[model samples]
Every structure is written in structure tokens, then in C-alpha cells.
Target: MNEWLIGLPEDQAVFVARVAIAFVVCLGAVIGSFLNVCIYRIPIGQSIGKPRSHCPSCGRMIPWYLNVPVLSWLILRGRCANCKAPISVRYPIIETLTAMLFLMVFQMWGNPAIFGLVRLQEPLLIPVYWAFAATIVVNSAIDIDHGILLDRFSLGAMPIALALSGFFPGMHGESVWTQGLIDSAVGLVGGFAGLWIIGLIGSLVFRKEAMGFGDVKWMGLFGALFGWQACVFILICASLLGAVAGLVLLLSRKAALCSAIPFGPYLGASALIWLFWGPRLLDWYVSLIVPAAL
Candidate 1:
């Protein structure tokens, strides 16, 4: 599919590639804009679709021209035009982060089979990873804000992920849907069960709910998209992150025994890490463990 692109003049190819990359980045920021809507409305049971963007401080409807992704926030000087209330920097941050993550996914997985050549297969898979990252962003923010993961996004991602795994060969490491579904199913079940066991043990030992049920479902969604190996990586990474952050909070005396921290953000951050480094890390782990197994 990309043979022609490969054959193009070097200068022409560079130009085309740059243009395409810009498009992808722009799309990502736009999606991030919608994600901000999701982050805010999903927790409050508000409809993201019906209401136009408005100021939380003052309920004036934001004009469409003033709602342009990252630019609007900067243009408004980080304040609401109507109420003069300060806007949260997280809005632009989310949009920028989404755009950056989108670019990273494209650069990493873009034209995976043919490193430098642009192809149809590459662009298709970019969104799969981006959506994965975006989910983490939204879910993490919600968890941090509310101390509970919302079922709406996490639960909704499951079917979407499975459908992609079943049909999109490019998304599968195997590059085939049959194997993709099998791998995805394994990851889904394994992730759900693994966390369930941990949660169960924690609850029994602590005489309290150690982990939220919402987190279990969230991991299941992640498992379906990236498979069991990635899920495992995410768990390991999240654990380390949680431990470090928890210790820091304890040392600073900012966190108390009864004070609860949201685990979802750590999990999401770990997933982001794994998204970029999972395959290489998995290979390294196998190399270390394979000799013992043999």
C-alpha cells in the first residue's frame, strides 16, 4: 500500500508526511476538546451532547468561536469571557497532552511495518492507542476529582475495544484478527480476575473495600485493547507509581491513614507508559525469565 509513497521523491515524501502529521495532531487536540466535556459532564450526569460549552462559574453559553480547543483558553487569557472567572489550566493541558500523545502514538506506531513510509495501516491504528490514552486521561481526572471511577467511560470502552481487536489486524501485535480476539479475550479475563482477587484479599484483610469495583472494570477495558501482557505491565507500573506517590504523601504529612487516594490515575499513568514501552519491556522480561522456564 505504501510502495508509491516510498518511491516518491524524498522532499515530496517529507512534505506529505509533515502535513499528515499536522492533521493527526490537530484531530487529537479536537478530540481532547471533547474529552474535556467528558471529564466534566460524565461525573455530574450531564449530557455532553446537548449543552454548548459554558462557564461553570457563570452559566453563560460560550460562543463557538471562543471555544476553539487550546487557542480559546489562551485567547481568553485563562478566564471566562462572561464571568471573568479563572479557567482551569487543565483544559488546555488536556488538549495539549492529547495532541502530544497522539503525535507520540503516530511516531511510534505510524507505519509500523514500514518505518519511514506512510501507509493506510498506520493511520488506522493511531486512534486505537490515542483513544486508550484519552480514556486514561479522562478517567484519571474523574477519579482524582470524585474518588470514584465512572462506569460510563470505562464500561463503554470494553465493547469498542473488543470490536477493534476482533476486526483490526493492525492493532493486534499478531496482525491478524483471529489471534487478536483470542489475545484480547485472554487479557480481558486475566485482567478482571487478577484485580478481583487482589481486591478480594485486600477487603478481607483490611475489613474494608480495598479497591473500587470500578477499577476492575476499567482494567478489563484496558486488557481488551492492549492484551494481557500490556495489562500486566500496566499493573506492575501502576503499583510502583502508587507506592512511590503514597510514600511521598505520607512523608509530607499531607495524607493521613483515613485519607483515600484515587488509584485510577496511577493505573492510567502506567498504561500510558506501557503504551510506548510495553513491547520492548516485555521482550526484556521474557529474556530474563525464559532461561529459568526452559
Candidate 2:
């Protein structure tokens, strides 16, 4: 075994790492499957946890074997067992995507070193990041389908993000607790206020409700987790991406100029990018533009 892997305390056994990774992957897949329920139900004002997983066509409760995430869909040939109604491909897709994302998080953060270090163990930041990503995935899908982000998701996400920010070590080796708290406070305020201001301006100019409250709340949640600087990056990146998407849709005759496009997905995408690569991307951009501007 490599020194890094073997150096972990006996209590934090190497076998535990494997188990942890497997648990996270399975949990993510299961959560993703549940998220599909949220996506379909939240839009239509249905309770997500109630009535159980059932076919919309025949209202038949899904059996345990048939509800086994990705495998079940394939086994049933993507049709409801009772009604033979063709199931939407979304279930397997969400499950697969979540499983992949969970695996990625495990690969990134499951180092024995992390578990062995007492300081690193306290705040549990990795799971927080996972939750953030999962929230983004769920909210983005909901927004795309309903043209609105649900309050349930956004409201639920913000405090978790804040808690994660407070727990995670600060950037540049600063005091983890203090800096994380400061960052979380600043990020929450900046994210909410900044977006709110823009939304006000947009509403005034357009003479209607411009930015959805959901977008603003989502940004605030992103800010709380990622800090103010990352929130700014998220805002800029999401806007640019949204504009590009809008332009593409327009050119393709898919969306009219006056049509409303939900901004939550772009924000979610930008936040994810920032989560993994914010500083590196910022540095690259600065290096590229600074010399030219100078």
C-alpha cells in the first residue's frame, strides 16, 4: 500500500474509504431518483414525498425491484410494468449523472489524509459541496421545466451552504473558522443584494418582473458556500452563458426575443464551475487580459 493510504489511523481504516465511496455513490443515485420526483411534482404543486413513486399513466405504485435506480429502468425496458406506458428517459439519466458526480467527489476528497487529519474532519466540507452540487442539479432541472426555481430547494440550500462555508478552511491559509464565517456572511449579503439591485433595474426598465426571486435566492446560496469572489465569477459566467444560449435559441428559431428564459440553470452551471476551478480560471483570465490591457 502507498504510504499515504497506509498512514491513516487504524480507526480510519483503508477499507472504510472504499465503503464510504460506495455509500456516497449509492446515496447519490438514490437521491437523484428522488429528485426526479421533485422535478415532476414541484412544478404542478404536488407533494414530492407523498403518494409514493407511481406511474402517472396508471397511478400504480412502483415495485421495489422496478425502482432500483438505473438498473430497474433498463430491466423494465423503460416502460411502466402495469400500464406499459413509456417512462421518460429522465430517471436513468438523473441516476447516472448523480452517481458519476458522487464518484467524482469521492475521488477528489476521500484521501486518507483528509480523514486522518483532525482539523480536516471537523467541518465536513466535502459532503457540503456534494449537497450544493446536488441542489444545483435539482433546481436547474426544475427551472428548465417550470420556468421557475422552487422556493423549497433554494431556501433549503442556503443554510447548508452557509454551514459549509463556516466549516471549510479559508483560502490562502487564513484562520479557517473566522475566515469561513466572514466569507459566508459577505457572500450571502453580496449575492442577495447584488442580484436584487440588478433585478430592480431590470424590472424598472422592462416594466415587468424581470429576474425571478428564485434566481436571486440561488445566487445567495452559491455565495454563501463559495464566498463573495466566487459569487461574482458565477454572476458573470452565468450571464455570458445565458446570453449565448439565448442567442443560439433565437438563431435556431426555438425561442422568440420576448420569450422568458429561466436564469437558474446558468447560475447553477456557473456555480459548479466556480466550485471546482474558480481560482485557476480567474488567474488564467487575469493573465490573458492584463497584458493586453496594459
Candidate 3:
């Protein structure tokens, strides 16, 4: 990477890197705009594209000038241009969140070779991770709004994840396509079965459906993208998160004891945590325990 930059002046290099980063952030915001459409339309069985963006209250088509992701929302003052009806703040929040997540992933995994921004690693992984993050965000948002996780987002992503793993063996930290595919398959089966078993046992103990089948499938998707090892770690993390959230809700009297709460967001959040720092944290935890156990 240094050799490639030898002929380039330092200031030019810095400018180019900054531009590339900005481009990715903007790209992510644009994708997030589409994701908002997916979140609203997918569950409702509406076509995401055909009608174009419009004010739901006034039924006025949104002009492209007014459709820019975060900027447009701010410019519009969070209201419909025609109706003056207040729009949900979620739009800009999702767009900004996606943009920030994209920048973080780029800092962690991006290669300047793709666009001459950062040191070369695997540039392809950048877009793959970006798309994965976007999907997770859409799923989390929808689950929060609807209390359901769509099979299309969970089960639908499995095959694509497997294909990506096979093509980019680095996805599974493997050198060979076969190994990557095998790892993904193992993760899919393990996560699905593990969660299903747990849900079954919970139902037996609680005398009701203890977990949504949607979550079981979503875990499979998680396994497909990550691996079986991640499945265990993420399950633990998500469980802890869910417990804390449920406890808070109960104490606040916002939700009754044993009331159903959306678990998909916790799962998605834990997966993102794993993407950012799970392996490092896991290694640290093991290092602390090993000598003590010995």
C-alpha cells in the first residue's frame, strides 16, 4: 500500500481517502433510503418501487429533489411538503445510522485498492458487509415496528450468504471455496437447530410459545453469514440484551411479565457487535480464563 502511494503527494492521498470515505457514507445513506421503502412495503405486501415515494397522508408524489436521504428530511422539516403532516423521525435516523455503520465497516474491513481510500485488504468484503448490515438494519426496524421478522429477509438471505461465502472464502476465514461453503452450511444447521430446541424447551416450561419461529430462521441466517461459533456467542449476547430490555419494560410497567417482546432487534444488535468486536472480546475472555483454570 505504501509503495502504491509513493508517487502520490501526502495531501492528495489524504484528500482522496477522505473523498472515498464520504462516497461510501453517502452510498450507504442512499441504500438506507431504499431500505426504508422495504421496511414499510415488505410487511404490507406493497410494491416498493412502482409507486415511487409519496406522502402517505396527502398522497402527493415526492419529488426527487425532496427525496434525498437525511438531508431531504432535514430540509423538509420532517413534514410532508403538500400536507404539512409530520413525518416520522425514523427516516433520517435510519439513513444516518446506516451511513455511520457503513463508515465503521469501511474503517475495519475496506481496501483502498477498490477506490484508493485505505490500505488494501479485501475491497469486495466492504460492499458485502455493507449489504449485510443494511439487511440487518431493515429487519431490525421492521421487527421493532411489527413485532415480526419476515422469512423473506431471514430465510431469503441464506442462499445468498452461502453463495457469497463460497465465492469469498475469506468470509469464513478459509482459503478454499469448499471449506467456506461447508462452514456456512454447518452454521445454518447448527443455529436453526439450536434455537429451535431452546424455543421448544422454553415452551414446555412456560406453557406457551416461548419463541417465534421467525427468530429461529433469523438465527440460521446469522449462521450463514457468520458461522456456528458466532451462533453460540451471539445467542448469549442477545439473550442478555433481551433480558435487560424485558426487565426494564416490566419495571416501567410498559409491558407485563411474560409479554412478548421483539427479539429480532437484539439478535441483530448482537450480530453487529460480533461483526465489530466479538472475536477480539472472545479471545480476551478466553485468555483471562485459561491461566486461572490451569
Candidate 4:
């Protein structure tokens, strides 16, 4: 990378890099704008594109100027221009969150080169993971709002992940693309089977539905994106998170003992964690469990 910039002045290189980062942030915000549509439309089977953005209370079409992600919300004071009705803060929040998350991923994974041999092919993974993160966020929002995960988003991403696996260089001391695909397959099957089995057992013991099937699908999808090894850590992390949060809700009377909580958000959050920390977390676990193996 330095060699590519060898002739360029240091200031120019820095300027170019900053511009590239800013572009990513802007793009992320736009994607978040689309996500707001998805969050509102997907649950109702509405076409995300046909109607364009409009105010629900006044039924007035939202102008392009008023629809510019987070900035628009701040400019309008979080109210509809036509109706003056308060818009949910979720709109700007999602936009800002998506932008921040994109920046975070770039900071963590962005380097001069990604793949050892295919330098150009490596940076493509950034957007790949970005879409995955977006899908997870959208799915989590839906699950939180509607208590369901769309199969179209969760299960639909599997084939894309599987295809991407062919190009994904395997990590964890493996570099073979075929090995990467195999890891994804293992993760998918293992996650689905593990969740299904646990849910089944829980239901049998309690004589009620202990878990939603949507969560199983979402987990399976996550496993496909990462791998079977990651599924273990992700499930462990999500379960603990869900348990702690559930207990808090119960204790605070926010929810009843039998109330169902959306589990997708926990899973999504865990996957994001694994996305950045999977390798380090696995290394730490292995070191603790098998000190002599290394």
C-alpha cells in the first residue's frame, strides 16, 4: 500500500484515505434509510419501494430533502413536515448506528491488504460483512417489534453466504477456500440442529413452546456466515445475554414469567461480537482449556 502511494505526498494519501472513509459513512447512512423502510414494510408484506417514503399520520409523501437519513431528522426536529407528527427516533438512530457500525468494521478490518495472495479480493469482504450486519440489524428490529424473523432475510442470506464462502479464505490456520465452505456448512447444520434440539427438549420438559423456530433459522443463517466453531461462541454469548436481560425484565415487572422475548436481537448482537472477536475469543478459550495443546 505504501508502495502504491510512494510517489504521492503524505498529505494526499491521508486526504484520499479520509475521503474513502467518509464515502463509506455516507453510503452506510443511505443503506440505513433503506433499512428503515424494510423495518416498516417487511412485517406487513408491503413493497418497500413502490410507495416511496411518506408520513403515516398525514399520508403525505416525504420529500427527498426531508428523507436524508439522520440529518433530515435532526433538521426537522423529528417531526413530519406535512403533519408535524413526531417521527420515531428509531429512524435517525438506525441511520447513525449503521454509520457507526460501518466505521467500526472498517477500523477493525480495513488494512492495505486483506487476502495474502489476492490483495484486491480482500477488501470486498468489508461490504460482504456490511450487508450481513445490515441484515442482522433489520431482522433484529423486526423480531423486536413483531416477535418474528423473516425467513426471506435470514434464510435467504444462506445461499449468498455459501457462494461467498467459495471466495472466503479460511481462517484459524486454514487458507483453503473449500475448507471455508465446509466450515460454513458445518456451522449452518450445527446451529440449526443445536437450537432445534434444545427448543424441543425445553418444550417437552415444560410442555410449551420454549423457543421460536425463527430463532433457529436465524442462528442457522449466522452459522453459515461464520462457521460451526463460531456458532458455539455465538450461541453461548446470546444465551447468556438473553437470560440476563430476561431476568431483568421479569424482576422489574416489564414482562411476565411466561412472556416471550424476542431472541433474534441477542443472536444478532452476539454475531456482531463474533464478527470482530471470534478469533481472539477462540484463542483465549483454547488456551484456557488446553494449555499443553499449543
Per-model lDDT: 0.82, 0.78, 0.87, 0.81
Q: Write the per-residue lDDT of candidate 2 for residues 1-294, one digit (tens) a residue.
A: 336567778566657677777888898899889888878887888988798899999999998788999998998999999999999998899888878777665555445443443222323456766776787788888887878887777778677666665666453224667787778878888998899999999999999988898889878877777777887899899989988988898888888641655788899989888866787798899999999999
Per-residue lDDT over 221-279 for candidate 1, one digit per residue giving the tens place of the 0 to 100 score = 77887887777788889889888888888898877632566788888898888778776
Candidate 3 stretches with Cα past 4 Å from truth are: 1-7, 111-121, 250-253, 256-260
Candidate 3 RMSD computed on C-alpha atoms after optimal superposition onto the true structure? 2.8
Clash count list over all predictions: 0, 0, 0, 1
Q: Write the per-residue lDDT of candidate 4 for residues 1-294, one digit (tens) a residue.
A: 535644567687677668868988998899999999999998998999889898999999998987898999999999998879999999999998888788767656564422123222355678887888898879989988899999998788888877778677553234788887888788789888988998999999999987899999888888888877778888899889988888898888887642555778988999999887777788788889897765
lDDT of 4 at 40: 94
Model 4: how far residue 104 lies from native, Å:
2.0
In the predicted model 3, the residue pairs found to clash are: none
What does candidate 3 score on TM? 0.91
Model 1: per-residue Cα lDDT at residue 90 = 96
lDDT of 2: 0.78
Question: Can you list the residue pairs that collide in candidate 2?
Answer: none
lDDT accuracy of residue 94 in candidate 4: 90
TM-score of each: 0.87, 0.82, 0.91, 0.89
**Which regions in candidate 2 have their CA more than 4 angstroms from the true location?**
1-4, 7-23, 43-47, 112-123, 171-173, 256-260
Q: Least lDDT summed over 10 consecutive residues: which range in candidate 4? A: 112-121
Off by over 4 Å in 1: 111-122, 169-172, 250-253, 256-260, 288-294
